[model samples]
Target: MYELSLIALIMPLIVGLLAGFIGSKINKSFTHWITTLGIFISFAISCWILIEVFLNPFLSFNQNIYEWMSIAGFKFLKRVF
Candidate 1:
């Protein structure tokens, strides 16, 4: 379970890196199409993930990515939580 969650977290970064690398080698028109298609696919997957979370909240986990300390006396934690 832990491993699966870790994989889920890392998969997007890996995919994005690969896509960006490939996109850089392609023509502008082709790169635009590829990027658009990738974004659409990502959006679809995100919707599915949201629906799954709604249907089964217990299956999801919160991941905190970072924290920010503001000089305006505001402390914020950047998170997937």
Candidate 2:
């Protein structure tokens, strides 16, 4: 679930960065195709995740990707759900 969530979130960023970096060197059509494909895949993954969550309401998706800070017995974590 976390993997799917992260992929759905990061796929666009990765694809955009890649497309932008190679946009000038590659054919415009190729870049456009890749960007569109990336967006579609990300959207599909997101829809799947939503369906899974809806089907399993008791499923816990609390995942901590990073711990930002810890002070005075308090922890600040970056969570993805």
lDDT of each: 0.65, 0.93
lDDT of 2 by residue, 3-81 (tens): 8888999999999999989999999999999999999999999999989989999998677889999999899999966
Q: Model 2 misses residue 67 by how many Å?
A: 6.1
- Per-residue accuracy of model 1 over 15-73 as CA lDDT, tens digit each: 66766888667686776666566566666666667677789968856666776666677
- Please give the range of 10 consecutive residues that has the lowest summed lDDT in model 2: 56-65
In candidate 2, position 62 carries an lDDT of: 73
Error in Å for residue 50 of model 2? 0.2
What is the lDDT, from 0 to 100, of the residue 49 in candidate 2?
Answer: 90
Q: After superposition, how far is residue 44 of candidate 1 from its true place, in Å?
A: 1.2
